[model samples]
Target chain A: MKFKQYLPASSSDGKAMVSLKDGGTLGDLLDTLGIPPDVPKLVIINGISRGVSNTVNAETLTDGDVVAIFPPSGGG
Target chain B: MEAWMGKILRVNLSYGDYHIEEIDPDYLRPYLGGRGLGSKILYDEVDPQVDPFSPENKLIFMTGPLTGTGAPCSSRYMVITKSPLSGTIACSNSGGFFGPELKFAGYDGIIFEGVADEPVYLWINDDEVEIRSAAEFWGKTTHETEDFIRAKIENKYLAKEIRVASIGPAGEKLSRIACVINDKNRAAGRSGVGAVMGSKKLKAIAVRGTGKIMLPDKEAFHKAVLHARDVIRAGPVTGEALPAYGTAVLVNIINEAKILPTNNWQVTYFETANKIAGETIAETILKRPKGCFACPIACGRLTEISDPQNTGMGSPKYFKGEGPEYETVELMGASCGIDNLAAITKANYLCNEMGMDTISAAATVATAMELYEKGYLPEKDLGLKANFGNADALIILTEKMGKREGIGDIMAEGGYRLAEQYGHPELFMGVKKLEAPAYDPRGVQSMGLQYATSNRGACHVRGYAIANEILGVHVKTDPLITEGKAEMVKTFQDITAVIDSSGLCLFVALATNFLYEEIQSLINAASGAGYTVDELVSIGERISNLERLFNLKAGLTKADDTLPKRLLEEPGGPKGDVCRLNEMLPEYYQLRGWDENGVPTTDKLSGLGLQ
Candidate 1:
């Protein structure tokens, strides 16, 4: 899993890969990592937004699933 | 014209007559310049009830005291008018060589009043202002118009260095989303400012000068400039990230927050954000980084798409141009659900050429796509399918919007009118007829209030609360809560008003380490207008109040200061799913010292020296 620049600095470093169980939901991983679930953030699994097959936080993560998290930022 | 060129050029195109007049120093002291001065002029000279396109309407292009003073990012000018789209006081700021050139040409600003009897373009060559017939250059694109006028000047000495501000076919056709573009890409890109120029049959403003600005305190100004540069260079965003990725650096960041506004605001996240993100552009398409005048933080992206299939121009194997910045990427890419960066880039190029506002243009198309998907709009009427994720459709629609051809005629009116025409006005993701730029208000809750109350209508720069709520640029606040947002929004809006009026890019204040004190010092040193931080803040407040007064007098009531129905009702992202606009607006009005109707009280006006 990779945390993008927008993630809270205290939560996780973008440089390291974290290990997780097979079939673990994104919410489960976030809970285990002590990441806040109620905040506005995007969950991408294996290069796709997590909502394609299931709710963003409930999407099942399998072996080798690449996950990344980011926060909101936009202006012209 | 001395110190700061205390002169303004008044051109009455109706009679092809113009005169240079001195601006009162008394007025200059209170209003400063740029947005503040422009707003004061508009409020005083033009009647609030007049039709925006009427001869009674006037367009003012004003620069600030710091402009042409070699201050960082000081190449800024403002175009102020009543918007044909929003029916509000509109002031659009642009950064390029034009503002500085105009300053060097011995004037602080130019005011265009009354419609022209024929097409004309203004030529300002160091005090010799001429309203030249523009019949030959009337139909040219902004780039071509600039080239044409620059080449037509009789003065051989300064012809090569002339700078131009122009409108293209979109503006010529009176498209409400049309913008005034300068220096190839930079634009006064909101509120139909270009259409105002077109209404007067003004093709462009060409300027050339050899005059030098005499700073009030040369040594102090230079020292402040250097300090400002150092401050920006030390900030993470201004020093590194922005230079590396341009404004698109926010693509993934915004998407990660699930506030990227995809599929016409129906979806909050886009799956292909990375493909059209800043990092991707830098790694693949970017040719080089560019910057505005005297700017050390070069965040402008210069790009080229090499694939022939991607360049909408059939035979062209490559296309090079200036941006599809974050707002363009989101509005033209994510909001339209077209993830193809090449198509978005092409659309961006077309917008620049057409002198159109990309945000409103894309928002117009996005609204149509929703109507099309819901079967409210038929293909027979559209001339093409506009399904979400259709990159080709995005390009086609953009070209159509620019030319105002076929169905483009209606779309050119902007999102509000387009949606209202289709009997689904609720589908229009906008406030006061102006489409909100990239950010989803449901994710960044404060932006909801900011957009609703923005004097120019749904603009981000008016009060970019996103910096605090999301990026933590100034102070980190809980994005999901409405608590303290009203006060935060008021502060940001006031400070931003100061920056906008000061002839400096707002990005420096938001993305760089240079804040209020540094900006105050720079303005003081350059213009010799010694002002405390509190006084600067008061000027910003006064400007905001004046704009509000105009809007109110023009008939916008408290009821008009609200977010779109969809954003207020629909669920969005994982956080507090809907925008808390109601909870914030009241608090915002209170903090602004306005009544429950969002009207500034006489006492408050008196306090700000407005009474």
Candidate 2:
């Protein structure tokens, strides 16, 4: 049911990845991955900022989806 | 008075009165300055029961003895006060020409007390200081407010460069994470101190001073400085990695190490981290190396992004500014699920210009995005569909939050409060109510403990375990194991307090001579004080205890020092990695010689010269 997977920037070309389950929002994917209800994850998709529960358009997964992700954060 | 301006200025907004008080040598010698001095003042002067945002809560902007001395990174200073976000002692340090300028202006610190009945700006010209009405400058952005103040002063020559620390509409509107930005974009951008300043009706503070500074031993000082300069230039991390790419380079490094937390910390890897990496950011937007006063490292980046969509007065790259450093990239880009170079750069610029803490604001928006995706908040409530990965919404929310308007209003409450308000308390990924920085706890185990006990909430700069976990600066360690991290964390915490209070940038931690023979050489040559490596290291320990004292006085208990539930419970990131905070906390307390509850015993405090 997972839609599209995103590889890590440091990955050798393409390896490590993250994906949202099909027809699932980001939060639901979190449940599937066992991410805590209160744990915060910063989600960046297509240069736009959103979080878990961000709906996954499965059809658009392999299209022009240039996404990034980071943990809850602060500037070092 | 030979080495110090020897006076602290106290401005009482509640009474519309101001006074100059002499700084005692007793306080100076014991606490040193910067965060150390600021901590002592807060511990002694502030009442624990007082509300952080109330006029009674004092915001102290303090510089150190070495500040303005042309010492490496001497341009640093810190703003210490009760933080609106964390409800603990918050000390957010910044670097630029401002700290030095404040020192030159014949003062050790500015102690802001009480709340102003109306908007105003503080004007300090050498010894002549005044509180001027700033109603005209109210709601203006930081750059504009500073520019307008100098215009009003009519000092002509000094007006153009009169260093100003100003708050924007975010502060004026009382955004909990609003920042006080100075020297264009060098910001003390954490913990909502700007909102506290704004609560005092203070728009900006303009300073121009020409007083010459006298060091304890000028000859020795120069020699030490020269030695440190060599250490910096020859050092691998400082000489090349930073000078070339800045902190943004960490994106690739950490991501490669598999500790780069992405998607609000739900994951430990960001596939597109390299897209907005330091090297790429430099190639695309970095114009030149920018520097703070006396800092040769010039780790700061001055950039110009040419994206037509992001071009305008609000964008930093529209003209130029300090940065979209690593943390900003993580917070504004990776944290929010945004992978666009121009978009994150634009948000970084806007945050700086509008006087906002990029970390908290990004985390807030990211939290809102998470919440919005969870159905806890509706698009109708936010006036827009703020689902995760909405780059435009992230940017717009950044702007709104900076102004404390629209959706920005809710986002600006910071991640913890915002999530709590939405009846989804567990979604807040913070320690001490301060939002966590990048680097998932699971992937980098020690980082979890580091964030848990950071003096200013969930900050990584306080004791970045990444040096060991990812970069292997000290030694390589399993990022997933909590085994011996307690001792390492305590050692770093102690040494960091020393370095931070000494007015040195943490990049020194990356210096090849991290053992500090070079710094030892510098200290001996300049101050004429023959200090061994052991003695020098002790300074860090001393400073750490002092900061702990301040936090203790502010009512932080061992219980208050903890990681968020997600890190502890969620097993999503790297293999079987959960925040081993509890595993390390007790050991950390033991290593710190504190009680089981993380409280510093009277004996331990006195042992460190708190006596």
Candidate 3:
């Protein structure tokens, strides 16, 4: 799996390659990355926003899927 | 008489006199001060077709009811006038101590009318007002002008308390992109509002007020304020991300989304964007985080550049100042193809000191660079090789543009005129006549429609659809899709209008779970107007329609509501999608209760009480 993380606490390099079982859910990926469940985040799976809320863990993930995680952030 | 000062100081420069006028109570709830109230005054007082530089044009400095009331991010004020660049209704909002200080000085706003025969600056110490000669400070930079004025005050303590809003040489020279600088750095930037002030030969307005703003229901106001503060403090975006990295945090995110405009929109992403991103600034030259009055987010950056090698040619090796906000970094750094953070920071300082809009100034230079690259602009006229990524050229051209010298003189007219002179208006990359900011709308589909319909030409803050389209704020929307974008754009625009009129920073909207209900509660307690959430939103619609009516009267037609040809026809972004403005505009007009030609229907105007 290809992962991009924008949270400073989660990943220092912002990009990572992870191995996941087939039919794994997004909750599994967050658990593996040691991301806290209560922290607000925006999860994008393959360029589409899965959710920005805490319930994004319900999203199902598959092999070769791209997941980008962003902290609550905005622009001017 | 709660929240609002309930008085306006009208200064007629031609006669060297002033008068105090009472603000009508009936206008307060609907207009709500700042942009809304100021625009109403402008529409009623000035002829729409009057030349922006003429003495007939009036410049208004207005503050909202929440201003100086200890409300979060209540440090904003609006400068309303006709834009010399776009000829549209200009209402440039700025944040600093100046707006609050003006309120404390016993006036809600100031109306500047007619031109002075000589350069002058206004001084208000409570009721003591004077139009002093500005001959000594006329050609000075904004910093120098402030210092000169402060030094002239015999009472040092009073001088220190005084907050001044002044123009630099750029405004004095009447550059189309010149902005008004307050508190030495914060600017009422964009739309050439400073040029209007310059035409009046009024250099600055220094105010020191000792009065407190009265509130009708202090207990209720405090209750609402404390709750809002808690919500803002807990927000992931507002409380943490913004205070930690400032607005430049978006540099990486937007670039990753492949929507960060680079090389003046010729490209959609910058490979070296990380060099100037917020993370890099935090790791490097950032001195500290700064905030305006009552601003918990503190998104402002206090930064310094000490490396001699990184500084631009003929610029200082060591300098400390307040920004290079996200727009500045993108437009002047990545958009101009120069990723040197130090150079970008120095250029930002120059813009602040010289009183120019960094967005338009940088976009104009980017246009010149493209013109030169295409062989349409001769090097003889430029006096140097104006190429993309030329840091020295960026700095040199910025200073020249401020002074209106050589090739900079042509650029001072703005990107539209600069490109039109070079025979490619299509290459200007703006709507109406004002240059667009840093976003590449081709990637964020709704932003294109936002840009097209903004009352002030091509402004992101007017309707930041990027919040939904890219950042996933409020609701996540597909950036590449056209479906439902029009309704989304209208809603964002209306909400934005309410925020702008409230004297609160738009960044507050980024807070997770914060919505119009919270805003309505704050406004009700602060102003004692008791508006419902829907009514507050309707007031925003009223303001939008009023400004649109003014623009239509100012000679703007449906045709002017458009993006650049490049955005519409040329493909860009990672997906190579062009901005489908046509797909969204008709629906937007319908949502706005406007006709197919983009004119507000009589029913819509009457419903909003504009009739």
Instruction: Indicate which candidate wins on lDDT.
Output: 3
Query: Candidate 2 chain B: minimum summed lDDT over ten consecutive residues — where?
Result: B522-531
Off by over 4 Å in 1: A1-17, A20-75, B1-3, B154-157, B312-315
Cα error of candidate 2 at position B268, Å: 1.6
- In the order shown, the candidates' DockQ scores are 0.13, 0.04, 0.36
lDDT of 2 by residue, B1-611 (tens): 54456788988877877899998876665555678788888877888557888878999998866678776767877899888878878888888888888889888789988888889888898888888889898989998897788777555898776899999888888888889999878889888988888888899888988997766677767777887787777765667667777788778656654566666776667778778887687768889988888877788898887767775365434466667888888777777788887778778878887888988888888888888888998888888888767788878888888876776777787888889889987888788888877777777778888888777778888887776665555555566678999988877787677666656666777765555565555444534445577765666676777667667767788877888788898874546467778888888888887898787777877777766
Worst 10 residues of 1 chain B by lDDT: B306-315
Candidate with top DockQ is 3
* lDDT (Cα) of model 2: 0.75
Error of 1 at B298 (Å): 1.6
lDDT of 1 by residue, B1-611 (tens): 23468889999999899998999998877788999999999999998888988889999999988787788888889999999999999999999889999999989899999999999999888978889999997888888888788777676667788888999999999999999999989999999999999999998998887898877768888999998888877765677667777889788777877788899999888878888888778878899999888887778889888777666342388778899788998899889988899889999988998899988999999999999999998999899888999988888888898888888999999999999998999999888999889988887788988998899888898988777676666666667788888888888898888898889988887554567898899988887778898889889899999999999999999988988888999898546489989999988898889999999998999998878
DockQ value of candidate 2: 0.04
| Winner by TM-score between candidate 3 and candidate 1 | 3
lDDT assessment of candidate 3: 0.88
In angstroms, give how far residue B573 of model 3 lies from its true place: 2.1
Please tell me which model should have the higher lDDT, number 1 or number 3. Answer: 3
Q: What is the RMSD, in Å, between candidate 3 and the native fold over all Cα? A: 2.8
